[model samples]
Target: MPQIKSLDELRNLRQQVERDISTRRHTGTTIIVGMGTCGIAAGARDTMHAILEELRKREIDANVTTVGCIGMCAKEPLVDVEQAGQPRVTYGNVTPDMVPRMIEEHLVKGQVVEEWVVGRLQSS
Candidate 1:
């Protein structure tokens, strides 16, 4: 690590750390998968893996993350997408098979895959 020589340097380091945390906190497009025990049993791991693979293949820049149960235990494998200035769309019972289309249409084309959506949370 480099030694901090001035207050400006400290400020710069702080800004960089904030940016890094923000990137991990959320991206322009965020893909959040439920990874709780129920979600895992419902194949959420496979769903998450598929989403990551598709993002890489398509060259999409988005934050992919996992969260605890979404309160809908029956909808264990739920996936949520939150894009800038858009409502967060939650999809229930997600499967690895639906990942590609979800990414292509929703993430790439800015369209919601209404067929898979269980609910939407409007942006605040």
Candidate 2:
């Protein structure tokens, strides 16, 4: 952890930790972005930024994480959305432009973006 030089910094760190814990506790929803070399080359960083921005703009709470290669080079910049009791859906060839609709439809409306989905895994 970084050194906390002031009380305000401590408070900010506490709030961030609390939010992380809360998000972890609510494992129902998670957004995973691929960050491997191929993914990064395909603009995963921008997609991730867009996802975060959209979530914040919509006041949505979700656990966003990153993963290494999943062996789908053709489908670089893959994004996965996992919700409680629902299949984990992976959207391939994701771009920053798609984040807003994906967030609105998947997170806010509780509907998957079927057309973008390339894979699905049931929770064990």
Candidate 3:
């Protein structure tokens, strides 16, 4: 954290924090990528980069995160999408080429790509 040198700076910092909090509250879409050893070996890093690029190109506000192994070694390069009021959907064998269509159908059109889905978990 940087030192707040002036009142205006403090006010600006507060406003920035408030905006970040508001964004988190409103944008309920979260994209979780598996970055475990098996996942990386299966090209998860490329998938993650593709995801971020697609999100940026579409100007979508999403919370992209990562996780370790989920015990599904066969299903490496797993990507999970969780949105408000919807079940978390996990897609297996995700590659960079599939990112655009996934984001388009899932995030933009509000439809899950059922064909690529490997798991689904309903939120409580």
Candidate 4:
């Protein structure tokens, strides 16, 4: 760390942080939906759409992405949310109707919707 020479430097650093937050909002998050063959057949596409719509409705910007199975093909239509320093929470067998509720209960409220999470078949 450099020595604090003048108040201007501190002000500049704070300004930079504020800018980063705004940028962060635009780059909000990485929301991954499993679209593996089984997942797609099960309805992951709809789940992805629902998630995007919910985020839009809530005015929360996020970078939504899709990927092949996490090897839990039985739990199709799985959704994962990863925020720095927080454990990844994965929702399985999700439906369009459940998106809003999931957002409210999980993303916004900081609560995991256990009923929707895949069975704890694996340890972190």
Candidate 5:
């Protein structure tokens, strides 16, 4: 870490921090679905479609992406939600039917559905 010498440096640091926060918070929500072989066998594609449909229906702007298995085979069909500055929440064994409420509660309302949360990645 670099030393802070003057108040101007401190102010500049604060501004940089604020810009980072705003960039993170305003970049929009991202939903990542695990699409590995196990996830596919467990119906992750349906879950992804359901999530996309819900977002379209609600007119919520978000990015829906896919990733390979995170080594949680038994917990196939895993879904990870990252809402701006919030921590990323991972849900296991997710079904298409659960997408709507996940969207409403987590993406739209900024509340994690604790019942379905299997893991949480804290923001740095």
Candidate 6:
């Protein structure tokens, strides 16, 4: 391994790591869980864990992320989902119980669960 003793060398290593991560970034599907204080208090971490466990059990390829709040603490545990060529959909008041249904409707069937969606958007 190349020596990384200097601060400049460390910066270069950091840049290289960032570049590698950017190259491997997921292009098809994603689920972003808001992880702000309110979200965590409302059990977003549990919701996120449930979602990830389901993905693992089902052997699905989905990129999950913890994101900053979208200024809707009233709707804590918000989740945003996006797929290739699909409009990004946001869900509010997420809970562990909702993860399975989300995976079924959004990931598998390509249909949004309007009841859980943040707004009155079509299920397509």
Task: Please give, for residues 20-97, the per-residue lDDT of candidate 5 as tens digits.
Answer: 665655778889999999999999999999999999999987889999989998998999998767899999999999
lDDT (Cα, tens digit) per residue for candidate 4, span 1-124: 9776987888889987787687786535668899989999999999999999999999976779999977888878888877655677788878889999988887788787888876432324
* lDDT: worst 10-residue window of model 6: 19-28
Clashes of each: 0, 0, 0, 0, 0, 0
Q: What is the TM-score of each candidate against the true structure?
A: 0.78, 0.84, 0.84, 0.72, 0.78, 0.74
In candidate 2, list every pair of residues with a backbone clash.
none
Clashing pairs in 4: none
For candidate 2, write residues 1-124 as lDDT tens digits: 9775777777888887886685567565889999999999999999999999988888877879999999997998999998888889999999999999898899888888899999999987
Query: In model 5, where is the ten-residue run with the lowest total lDDT?
Result: 16-25
Score residue 22 of candidate 4 by CA lDDT: 70
Across 9-123, the per-residue lDDT of candidate 3 in tens digits comes to: 7788898778688767766799999999999999999999999999899888898999999988898899999998899999999999999999999999998999999999998
Best by lDDT: 3
TM-score of 1: 0.78
Candidate 5 error regions (>4 Å): 1-25
lDDT agreement with native, every candidate: 0.90, 0.90, 0.92, 0.81, 0.90, 0.85
Error of 5 at 23 (Å): 8.2
lDDT of 2: 0.90
Off by over 4 Å in 1: 1-27
| Candidate 6: pairs in clash | none
Clashes of 5: 0
Better of 2 and 4 by TM-score: 2
Taking every candidate in turn, the Cα RMSD to the unseen true structure, in Å, is: 6.7, 4.3, 5.0, 10.9, 12.0, 6.5
On a 0 to 1 TM-score scale, where does candidate 5 land against the true structure? 0.78
